[model samples]
Target: MHIFYTPDITQGTYTLSEEESKHCVRVLRLGVGAVVNLVDGKGGFYTAEITSDNPKKVGLLITDVKLEFHKRNHHLHIAVAPTKNIDRIEWFLEKATELGIDEITPIITDRSERKVVKDDRLNKVITSAVKQSIKAYHPKLNEAISYHAFMNLAFEGDKLIAHCIDGDEKSYITDLVQPQQKYLILIGPEGDFTPDEVNLALNKGFKPLTLGDNRLRTETAALAVCFEINYLNR
Candidate 1:
């Protein structure tokens, strides 16, 4: 199915962007009366038909709409430190979106190698993943912020911080996670969170999460958390 990201679509006829128009008419060669799909990235999935197959501005008429499409019972929010290699973090974003996640925040910690992230490029990765997976909901990508600043934000769910240090005191994610509950998990950078950072998160009611004995890379750890949470929910 040819799916276009139409975040602003409502109940009516809609026009594809110039880039999408060219891909639809010239590349895909979809002509008038051809059927296509649209996702608003806000729980809206729509079926549209080609009205005017102009290469510069393909017009579409909305034929059907489904709200809250494939809605999940649980909400997951992961605040992970970005990797030094930008591609690794981008890979995590793409896989996390494909696997199913509600929100993501790039966090900066004391041992963080890379602190800055291009929001637009990361968002595009997520957008492409959403379309490839045929998902109606779009995962939210928050701007990069300090670890302390992120901790200050209020979260009314199961807060968790994953780290390799202090393994004895930490609990495996499966031991703590319950089905159909909201979850907010924190993943550290390559160097992992400092001892003080873990202590601070503990003081703030965030439980320590341990993936396993094997030490995983920054992106791998984040994807591990994503898979575990989504699996438990499933």
Candidate 2:
């Protein structure tokens, strides 16, 4: 099934954008009456038949529509500093979306290597992951913000901070996470979080948790925590 994305779909006839039209009529060579699927990335999926094969504005006749409900009982939000290698960070977003994440925020920490991020590029990676994984729900992607600013966002769930700081008291994320509960995990940059930053998170009621024995890269740690939370929820 070839599933395309469109934000709006009305009754009778709908048109595909130039990029989608090209894919359907030119690349795929889908003719009139061909079966195609679409998603609005807002919990709506449709099964439609091609009405026109125009490569500039392919038309479709909506045959069936299915409204998908939010499936997960728990929410997993990860906020991490973008890595110096943008590809690695993008990889994390893809894998996390496949593994089922509700939210992602790019944070700017004191030791963060990259301050600016291309939201459009990252959003495309996320969309591809959702389609590839055959998932109806799309993950929420927040614009890049400073660490201190991100902390202020209202989160009605368990909050955690993962850092490489020295502390005798540290619990594994798997142990701290409970089933059917909302969660947010904060992963630091390559240089890890500054002492002041860790203290700030602690003051905000964020628990300090460790990923594992072996030290992991920024992306690895972020993905690990995302998967671990998903596993526990299941």
Best by TM-score: 1
Per-residue CA lDDT of model 1 for 66-163, tens digit only, reads 99999989999999999999999999999999999999999999999997899999999999999999999999999999999999999988999998
lDDT of predicted model 1: 0.94
TM-score of each model, paired residue for residue: 0.98, 0.95
- Badly placed stretches (over 4 Å) of model 2 are none
- lDDT by residue for model 2 (101-130), tens: 989999999999999999999999999888
**All models: lDDT?**
0.94, 0.89
User: For each predicted model, how many residue pairs clash, with residues at least 3 apart or on different chains?
Assistant: 0, 0
